[model samples]
Target chain A: MIRRLLLQHQRLWLLTIAVLGALFGLLLLLGALQLYFDFRSVLTGRSDLSQAQYIVVNKEVSTMNTFLGQKGFSTTEIAELKAVKGIRDVGALTGCRFDVNVTMGGGAIEGVPGMYSDFFFEAAPEAFLDVQSDRWRWQEGDSVVPLIVPKDFLRLYNFVYAPSQGLPQVTEEMLMLVPFNIVIKSKNGNVLYKGRLAGFSERINSILAPKNFVDWSNENYGPAVTAANEVKFLPSRIILQCDDASSPELAEFMSEKGYQTNSENLKNSRLSSLLRVIMNVCVGIGGLIIVLALLIFLLYTQLLISRSSYELQTLIRIGYNPKMLTARYMRYYGLIYLGILIVVVAVLWIGKSLFAGFMDEKGFPVPDGVSMPVVLLGVGFMVLFLVVNFFTVWLGLRKLAMPR
Target chain B: MQLNFRNVLPIPLADTPLPPGSLWKSDTSFESQARCLVQAPSGTGKTTIISLLYGLRADYEGQLLFDNQDTRMFSVDQWTEIRKQKLAIVFQDLRLFPQLTALENIQLKNELTKTLNEGRIREMAEQLGIAHKLEAPCGKLSLGQQQRIAIIRALAQPFELILLDEPFSHLDEANIRKAAELIMQSCTANGAGLLLTSLGGNTHFDFTQHLTI
Candidate 1:
């Protein structure tokens, strides 16, 4: 009887649904925003070390080595740095055992300096390097050596070196066009090789050559490097490619070990943490809105019950327990919650679809399904609404039965 | 149930005109197989007394004991049991759920126990002159006809006591007697006590005892 009679308040119920659905939509939007950005940052490598999962570390050059060059990490120091937590893999930087110069046809170009102008050549483990192309490897019979020049080198040449020398500045494409001869001279022998630029490295700061080329150059012409440059045979810089570049623990360990990394590495760690804090705040606000919506829904329900208090009192006097009457109310409010759940789930599905499509367009990994945390949030929201409404109706009915 | 009232007067009014029975005094115990009239003029809180007896109100002074147990100490569950099994009422306002049909209003009480079948309910409705009006919404019915429906609704449940507060206020004397006959048979067959409150002589049932409050 109470169920049928209370149907007069059609507008009240519609208002309840409208308000709840709007709030629920906002919550889903916030959740989708958080998920999309977090996914984008990780997939595109904006979050951690420019998507390479590797940070370049070395010993900062002291004033004593400033005129010469940076000092190298010894093998013992490299082993100790490998023990740092979160350091997945570490590779050493191999310096040229002998000084080398590049010239076209064994002579300096008209405007471009080549022969007798020394340049550093370094090699690192191919797995840890930024350039992934097979062009970086070489064979013994192969005369052509693949090279990876650092982006900072071109920038320095364009902005600083070319203007002062009154020489024509070359673009990356023009530089890749030149097939040059690398001349290595030592007491053992002189080796000549053909080489071209493979790519540019953002994480590594020096020109890179094939490990085969560097080994051959060192074995043949190593004795030519005088004691003035470097007396040691070990590498000059070390690279540690970590799995999690955003970890502050890695930074603390690096500081403790007197190791140095580039400014961009530290900047990326801060960006990752900032994104995390924003995501957390969004989730917190979404949670708070859900709680407030529940409160409003409770008040709305009690108002309806209060309007029907006289009818409830009549039912109670006729030997109808108040809880029995309120139990009928549970079905009524339960259906409302079910309706809200359907709306939120549908909207969330659509939102996730749209986001997933965007991710595919951006070349990010498309998720197999909507993330588990968002789905769990949707379910938790529904359960909480139903539970709160159930108790609200029960308490409202009991209050109606109380003497006024 | 033995209902005892010790100095059970209602709280005095602030400044409004007080009715003759405002300062009521009553000591009573009646068996289930009896009929009683609580006589009072209008504005005398006769509905208040019914509400207190039904365990709906507890603001009045003094103790209202039922079967030697104070109604004050009764839990909500106890009150529900008492109302379902030991007490029922036809309020002065004839508090029917207006959206339900007359038959539905009556069966809302009967559904708790299924004490009275639909056929028996229709028979009693015919006797009280509301048989033809059973299908109409209670809010659409005449007040006199709704009163007959309220009387039938209260009597449809199993109870040890039935309290009627001015139930016949809108009924003619002939219709009131017809409704009263149905109530008497229903209460006597269930072995329940009958207590009716009225402003004047609208009922003529043989009283087991009369209390002037």
Candidate 2:
């Protein structure tokens, strides 16, 4: 009975427009959220390192540096690079300063022939190494040295070098069991050490040994320093841990310092950042639309209250409680908002399924249903809208119930 | 249950010369179950008195209290509780939702109070000679019919006080007698006080006290 009296003067056209506006706004908001979720999953699936959080940078090798034999970063340069914005930490790729020779193949854990070649080694901090293995450790007196070789080296040998040389290719498990000898030649003497492959790294490209072993061997057998107190050696390359490799500030800093890194990784990072900015803009527009829709809903409520002021006053005068009237209005609009949420969810589910199928056909597979975060966001907005509208109704009726 | 007027005068009538023996700007109190009739001519703030007592208008010089609680300090919820269970009113304008049927107008209040069943509501409509007009929209009904509908709406609630602001102004002698009888019967049954305002005409119910405003 109270609903009949209070709603008699409501303008249905205004309400219908408001509801439509709410629907559109919610669809846009949830749709953008769902798309962001799918896009992130696709990116992570394609390549984990494509996020470009870790990058390797080096000085640009020019003719002047080559002529001067000065292709390494000094301590002051490393310190400056570490202080650059977006660069979290810097670890130098310390190269072997002593002459080294690796000999393998004849009875080296069942290889077919004898082979000997000069090899180079670089050492970086364990934190930057991607390969996790117990053997990738060494103490000063340990006779055997654990090494991490680049995975691309295995691919290169298997795909190009082995077939061309008429040699058999080996798997990673088989190579891990092989042991070779390393001969370190120094001004003091020649030292022989056993070398064993620990694991392969997909992130770093160098043949890596434990940092302590490299430092120990360099101190014992490396060439004498020009000065007694000069202990630091310049690194030719440095691997950086950065907050966002895509940030233009880092790029500008690198360029200003004449540093170079993998251009492909930077490109991918920039692409990801661009996508995020676009998504944020879309979400912002959706939020603005929702605000405008809420404003329209409030205006409609005010108009209804003023138009039905007489009837409301009559209801109050006849002993109808204002709270009861407000509750009736809340229930009515709550159901409408619930209906809007259901419609938005259904539409988003269908739209996402179709879009996911399209993406799958293009070799990018996203989740086939509406994401959980999107549903939660939609319901959260609905609840917010209901609360705002509820307050409007309550305030309007209270004014009518007790005019000041 | 008690009405206390402490030197209450409508803001608009503050500068005017009130008649002698008038209730305005005086400290007066009416105890529970007292039947009081206020007789006054036009433009004498009769409607203002009823509006003030019913928690509609607060533009007065002094305070109006309901059972020793100042009406000016009442919250919305408190006023609603008072209207639903403590006080009821039939406005002078006959503020009915004209789009609703006369039966719906009464049921609106009955639904909130739940003090009367549908059969009781129909019985009261029959007593007031409005049973035939119960199904008709209040907008199409005559002024007397709408007034009777408003009265039924007021009686459909439980109350300690019922304020009737010129309730029978448009009714004939026969209908007025019937309305007054039904109203007095409801008041006696509930042990509620009645404050009926009139424009100096024939009095229908036996009043325990009379005052001019």
Candidate 3:
């Protein structure tokens, strides 16, 4: 009956649908923003250190440091880096006090007792490390250590060391499966342990280990390093998570402190927050538009009921309850709102498909299936729309059906 | 099944279709099995009396009791149930939906009452001069045809009393006789009363009572 009645007013309904479509599209955009951020955050965690906003910042080697062998970044330098603005977090590197070597099966490399290559370790706090493969952690008594080598070292071995020594260069995958005995040596004693490859680092050009294992080993085999007011025991490099690499304030601060960053082209991960602000503005505007649209719809509904009040009053007089009258019109409007919801979902899916490649390039990929969060958000908005309009329609009917 | 009007005087109401006149200034009892008439000149509150009894107007001054219960205390649901199962009315303006077909207008009442099927409605329309006019929109029908449709619709429900205000004004004597016969038969079958109002002496039924408002 509502369909038959509304057919005469198709223009009115079409206008309503236009406004509703705009609202649905805005809500879908908000949902898409949520999906983009979540996917990007996940990808950032899974990818290399290249996407990390943090940089391994250190001071340049001066004449005093080269001549005096004072290569460590002092505690004062670490404090100054912490005080720098636009930096969210800071963690200094803890270095090993002993030389390290690795061999296969806890045995000698190439059947020699001491033919293993030279390597040392540095430990950054786990929060700063981008790659968190299960092989990256260590326990005190654990027989196996984890190796996060430098991609530069791998390339050098493949192109230079392999050709010079006539030894076959191995892939990262093969090297990962081969367990090597890690021997940590000091003037007091030498400790032998097994080690497995964790992953390669893209930014820092040093072998990295867990911070706990590094501190314990440094205490047991090397000179005791104080945490404050010391230069030799201090970190060699300070990593600061930058909000914006090109931010002039950060650039000025770095220049004033004579700090240089080895990780050039720092990923401006704070773009997420900026984009969130933009999306929130859009959502706020969308919310206001929705409110305005609802008011228009309410006024339109009142006009329609006013125009049809005679027939409605006649129906009410014919024993039709107010609930029946209200429900009949509500169901009609509910179906229209439901139609808007469907269109929103369809368009959002299409939008995701159209921008999948772009999002993937930005480290956030649109999934193939329907985005559940977007759909849920659309549903939420649809329900709110219906709930708000349901009252307007009911009030109109009550006004017309009841004695004024 | 009983309506009591006690010192009821019509008061002005906004958007009220009722005329400005009192129903009665004294107690009057209308029963389910009783037939009554309200005789008055045009615009003398004939429809106003019916509208007040129909619960369409509430601005009248005094008490109306349905089976000794005050009508004012009746909830909207109670009034709805009473209208659904007891009271039926044929408005003077013939308040049929203009967009609906004659058959659809009758079917709207039939849906509420569950008293008449399509076959019975078609039979009733055939008995009148309107079986051929049933499929046409009510707006397209002549006023006389719409009147017969309205009378058939009023009889389509189970009722304690059916109010017909100036129902046969548009119909000729022959069509009035036919519509009256149908209304009388339905009222008898349902064991209900009929309260009909008219401007002049045009009714043919053996009315049980008469009143001048």
* 1 against 2, candidate with superior DockQ: 2
Q: Write the per-residue lDDT of candidate 3 for residues A1-404, one digit (tens) a residue.
A: 53465334435674566466556555645554655544554534432223437678877779988878766666666676677777777888888877887655435345322436787889988887766597888888888778788788889989999899878887888778876777888768788887888998876667888788898888888866575435666687767776655444676677676777764333333554455566777677767666667666666676667767676777788888878877877787778778777776777666667676676787665556455655776678668767876887677767665542
Residue-wise C-alpha lDDT for candidate 2, range A1-404, written one tens digit per residue: 66776788888899999889889988988888788767766754432323436788888888987776665787888899888877778999988888999998776555457879998899998888889898888997889999999999999989999999998999999889877899999878889999999999877888999999989888889975666424445788899987666565777788888888974545555556777788888788889888898999889888888898887777766666778778888888889899999999999999988998899999998867887778998889888888888889888887777745
DockQ of 2: 0.60
> On residues A273-330, what C-alpha lDDT tens digit does candidate 1 reach at each position?
6666676677667666766677777777777677776776677766678777777777
- Candidate ranking under lDDT, highest first, comes to 2, 3, 1
Runs in model 1 deviating more than 4 A are: A13-26, A33-292, B13-27
TM-score for predicted model 1 compared with the true structure:
0.64
Collision count for each candidate, in order: 1, 0, 0
List chain A TM-scores, every candidate, in order. Answer: 0.57, 0.79, 0.63
Q: Write down the C-alpha DockQ for each prediction.
A: 0.37, 0.60, 0.45
The lDDT leader among the candidates is 2
Q: Highest DockQ among the candidates is held by which one?
A: 2
The residue-by-residue lDDT of candidate 1 on B17-103, one tens digit each, is: 544444355455666556878887777677777878888787877788887888888877788888788887888888887788999
* lDDT (Cα, 0-100) at A128 in candidate 1: 68
The numbered model that scores best in TM-score is 2
lDDT of 3 by residue, B1-213 (tens): 888889886775333444344356767887867888888887667887888788877787889898999887777778788888899889999898888999988888888867888898899999996899999999999999999999988887888899999899888999999999999899889899988898887557888877766
Better of 2 and 3 by DockQ: 2
Q: Mind sharing the TM-score for model 2?
A: 0.84
